[model samples]
Target: MTDTKYRKKLLMALLAAVLMAAMLCGCAGDSGDGETSASSLDGEADAGNRDNAEETDQNMELAGSEIGREFTERDRDSSYTESEAVQIELEGNSISADGRGVSVSGNTVTISEEGTYVVSGHLNDGQILVDASDSAKIQIVLKNAEIYCGTSAAIYIREADKVFLTLAEGSRNVLGGGAEYTDTDENTVDGAIFSKADLTLNGAGSLEINAEYKHGIVSKDDLVITGGSITVNAVSQCLSGKDSVKIADGVFVLNSEGKGIKAENTDDSTLGNIYIAGGKFTIRTEDDSLHASGSIVIDGGDLIVESGDDACHADADVVINEGTVLVNSCYEGLEGYRVVINGGTVDITASDDAINAAAPKNASDTGNQDRTSRQEGEMQPGGEALQNSDMPDEKESLDGEPQNGELSQNGKLLQAEELPGRELPQAGGMPEGELSEDGEMPAAGGRRGGQMPGGGDTGRGSIENDSNAYIKITGGELTVTAGGDGLDSNGSLFLSGGTVCINGTASQGDSVLDYNGIAEVTGGVLMASGSSGMAQGFSSSSSQCSILRVLDESQEAGSTVTLSDSAGKTFLSWSPAVQYSCVVLTSPELKLGETYTLSAGSENLEITLDSIAVSNKTGGMIQNMP
Candidate 1:
């Protein structure tokens, strides 16, 4: 062997030994579960992550678990074995019981113990009363029962841990209550089926409730309906739950003179909510169809509402995760402090603002029977205003409201810092596109302040400071035909991914898109048309391109507004039900530094997408650039 060969083999062996040592050191640095060693510098960060995980678990428990729970197999069981049940037979104006816990009176039947009672009978004028121990759980299975109470609740639960009213399969039941409640003890019983404890209604049967005086089904605690086909006709609320109202799956046809469904607990922040996981609802009401003082969560459902007031209202938040909501007619379609639509199909036709994000004056009042109107001579919540007044003769605030005076042209009050040297008769005061003696109103998009068209401080901070009033549409298809502002947000409006088409008011005092803070469309298709006097374009913070054009003349109703590229291929088109003098269009397909053609009726214009937000006065109305 040569000396050079021996030296090469020795060097190779040394290199292999060094690599093996490095691999062992790397393994030692890990804590065997892919985490770093606790003694390392990253120990504090790992501890914080563990703490966050525990906090998230705690928050999830408090989120909606207190409001309601999904039905377990035990809750839906309507069949009780002979050994575990008590038998009660109801004869006309009399009753017979073969159970130890039940007793018969002249015309009423009372159950005094905790057990399952199968009731099948016809009661002409009597009541089924449950006066059990406070810690007892009771179940009353109604099978082909017809009950009526002339002066009290048909089925009243005075005390219990929880009561399950199970409608037997394939059976039909009817309960009718009188105009006055006579069973008044420690609790007021004003419903056909009134319970002081938590109540659960489940089964595959059907029940019809006719309430002559007050609510149809009243529960002082949580009220949950997992199944069954129920129809309710009431003078006041069809379903009133003091703590919460939760429906997992059911078919409901409710008609009421007051409200369709409501939750009226305001003492606790976690109570007074409504959660609908899956159901079918047809509600016609004189007031709001669904009202909650805390919050509302709609995971999946089909809701059709014809309401004299709002279709859905919540004092805290209204979230639609997935559902089909059709508001055929309403005053305000959806009103809440924060309205969020993650995914759904929503169609709204409203006389007032279609989707509003405004705080109610009294958050505790879920009924909202005394909402103030924004009319001439009426004052705002926190201040006094002149009757039929114009712009105040004082310095204007940064939010366009007068600082030292009481009148704002749009009838809203603001508590904002003063911004001097601004002229009177500010923008957004009159109806959009309304003309002055000079043939044009002031520039609507150049307002110095943010408040316009019911924008106020609202006790919530400005939009930049975590304001509670906002409209967020992450994904959905929203079509709004509104007589007032199509989408009005007092704080801000956010559109990330969705399709929004608004046909706004043709007259004065409203616009297609009105926001006090900012309207940002990062990824969405928005086609809005309305009056031009109070017109507004998207904010410059948006990533997409938009076109805001004021037409030369009013476009008649049913005139198609189209946006086409230079090749004349249309990309977007919509026909407004009402006349419009202004149009706003934006989409992801619209590219910056591109030119497009816009057509409305016989009018055509060559529009170049020059910037993120473009405002043009094509009809020689007024030229303002932002």
Candidate 2:
């Protein structure tokens, strides 16, 4: 109670009043202002985020491949008149020319100008040579004409814009070649009908060709067949068109020692193409049946091929829009980098990869280093050459195996690729250390990469493991039975729609479906059953899929596999589709985590999971099915 205590109390009361005034001003003036400012800022940030999301959605798209591109460069106009049919009769070693532009010199009947000539009679040792203007189109009508060339082609078209070989209605024609060809300084004519210009064969009648030299029909340019009934028997190749071979309608029976029908232009990558719109072909060959470089498109046909190698092979894409292809026996059924089967009824039985997507293999596909400087030539029967006066002056062999840089199968300008004993079988026929002079193994690998014998670097064989191969099916009804992988894509496999039944369990070393990249099944009916070791299934990145594994016991062959919903509604079913121990079923109808029953005959499998389907799958061995 003094003067100092009174001053201390007054100061403390003033300090408390000052603090209260500051608190009241803070609460009443701008305490909620920060929240209002932040609300506007948050709204601006959200607007910016929405714009980014919309921009991202617009920029996303899937890239397409070049597997199913349309080939529209086809010639369908072949209507020519046979006015003033001149007659040319062959007698012994001389020819009687009765045509306007025909002349006879020794055993050769030469046509020097453009005209229509009707040829009938037998030529024992002679030829019909057409040497006309560059723009002229010569038509030769065969009315029961039988010609045999002892040293050259029976019909030699040395120069012209194009030549048409027409078989007269109700007439039978024959053109045959000998074993030893008359080799010129720069050329060797080895086909029964050899032409330097574009050649077309059309008629409603039948013609038979026996090519004992090299090929049956050889054209340096394009070769087309509109309508005919033709049969070819050749020692090397049956029909070889350098630029392109387009067949609209024909009944062909081609039996060859090397290849059936080929269009190979190694000089120009886009020139070698084959388009078959309609035909009835039954081809038998020791090598590829239908081979090309650019593309192979079959619109509609009934093709039954029995080949030693691939049935249908192309370096580029192979598109089968519509056809009935039945490859009865083959090493590889169908081969290409991009194989697209839009619609077809294809049944193939192969010893190797049935439907393989791979890059082109050259003679240099081998790892051997001694590929260059290998010379190949056609030797006579007794290892000698017999010269003739009717030979060309520029014949150089196109190596026994194609080098992927030159046209190798023509007897007119580009000399045919000829070797000794080209007709012999080569599977496991070569010695272990000895190689063929063509720088290839006789037959080394299964289906692909068959080694060419000797120090040669090329041969028909298995495709080396590459990563650019793929298969896309838009629509088809394909049944592939393979001894190797049924459907093997070195890259990814994409299916939008199709009904593919693959029976690839014919071999134990491969799978039913072996893909190196993604295997996506968006919309399709895929029943692939094969070896368990390499039977990789669809990728998880696919949309709405299911994986199932049956346990307790393995399903036997010839059993029906049926799937149903919990309410006894059947969704998908397959009977006697394939043989397998470990099976993986994937489809869009599989509801995730749903209970379903899968039965193979009397064997039942029940599975319930969180996703479209469930499985307790363990890997098994790959064994060949009976």
Candidate 3:
């Protein structure tokens, strides 16, 4: 073997070794990349599982919190068996007969025995039925509890003595399910507390009763809400008491299909009284807002009633002494036996009569007869007769018979004292004095009698005019705008004090001051205007007549003048003077082809241009001036 051949063989061997090592290293690098990819996939799966677990834990916590705060547990042993009588005590604390911190799951708790039972916790929840079974005497007090009854009333008491259910401070009692369909017919959940006894609510609490079919609070006796906020969204009556319902103070919001508050007595002898002394009451109903068979008295507090029917309907008197009462009704605003408004700001907007006090048609026939008799004449004590002896006699008297004279003449003789001294005339009836050259009587003792220089009717005094009806303005500034006659009275109109501005239009085809009564303005300033066309400014037909006498006897008098009546719109004006005139007509001087805004005092005068006739001589003629 040659030396070069041996060296070549060794080099080939070394090269072969290096190539094998390179191939093994490449295979190992590929295996490491696959392991890294597998590890990253596992880490992503673990992170996703952790996030899901956290979300599930959060949901469970929320559910637990809701359940813990929503309801309190009651022991099962505390359950009252069917027809079993149990007595529970409550003194501003929670208690259940089943046991403390135990939930009640039962059929019914029949209160058959007559005793006072106090329930501090939630009364009816989860089929825990409490049936009074028509017991005559039973009482239960529910304080600080949430009672929910599915397809049943939370608390039902029939013929009970007194069921005092008091919601704790900052707590509420919610009744009925959340469904749009009303369950009034069947399976209806009624009020949170329904009682046959005298119902009373006190303290700072709340009762939210949503009855889709029945009343929110129904009581056979008196229902007194002294304190607490009560909300009733009922399909029927909200608060109904057989005797009376008195609200002293609280926030009561009632939305009912029927009456908002009803106090109807079953017996005719017993009168139901609905008195709201103090409280903020807001009622929106489809029917009467506040109805009582006896009477309704609102002494204080703010009351707002919006009803489709009458806002307030009372069989007896409806008295509003104080408070702000706003009523917006489709029908009559207020209907009662006698509505006496002593104090209170009442704003009523009604489609029908604003206030009606007519006697009910269902009143007794004897009552109707008595009312008629009272209206006919006045009654004295012991029913004594006070005849109308001052009535005017409607008889005519003939001439008295002639006294026994010397010749027994049939006609009476005229005495010298009875005749005028200066008068001397012959049988031909010529004046004893001489006449002027123009055939006129002398200025001294003329052909007729002693007369003034001018030939005018001097026998008639200054004629006075009267208004339509007697309008007594005692106090308060009033501004009246009447579509018909301004203010009509059949008697004397006395204006004691206060300012009155009347803008009234007369009847069509009638005079403006077609008054049949006296307008005796004693005090206060009066500015009145009427319609146009043959309408006198002020007219009186009485013998005494309508005289505008100044309050201060020394202040003199004035005349009521008609300034302008352009297009049947009469504007009455007045000016002061020593001697008053009956009516003064003024023709306004309107500019040619220029508009003018005529005003009386501070009020704008309503004028019609068509009724104005522009005269080339004077400015224009306000035709048919009042």
Best by TM-score: 1
**In lDDT terms, which candidate is top?**
1
TM-score of 2: 0.69
Residue 207 of model 1 has an lDDT of 94
lDDT digits (tens) for residues 1-626 of candidate 1? 11111111221222122211110000112223322111211122223223322111101212432545466676666566656788878787788888778988888889888888988889999899889899988888888899999888899888889999988889899999789887568777889999999998998889999999898999999888888999999999999888899898889999998899998786776688888888899999988899988777888889999987789988777788788999998878888777888888999998767898765546333312122322232224223442423323322222334323222224553211111233212222323343434322222232212122233311112212113457888888999998667887655678888898999887434678765555677888989998764466676657887777766667889999999987888999999888887788888999887778888866777776666776643211221100
lDDT of 2 by residue, 102-169 (tens): 88888888998886788888889888988899998787888888999988999999899888888777
| Root-mean-square deviation of candidate 1 | 21.0
Ranking by lDDT: 1, 2, 3
lDDT of 3 by residue, 255-353 (tens): 998889988874752457678878898999988899887777777788888876667877655666677777744354555544445455565655333
Where is model 1 poorest over a 10-residue stretch in terms of lDDT?
19-28
| Residue 5 CA displacement from its true place in model 3, Å | 99
- Model 1 residue 477 distance off true place after TM-score fit, in angstroms: 1.4
lDDT of 1: 0.68
Off by over 4 Å in 3: 1-107, 110-144, 150-152, 177-192, 366-626
In order, candidate lDDTs are: 0.68, 0.61, 0.41
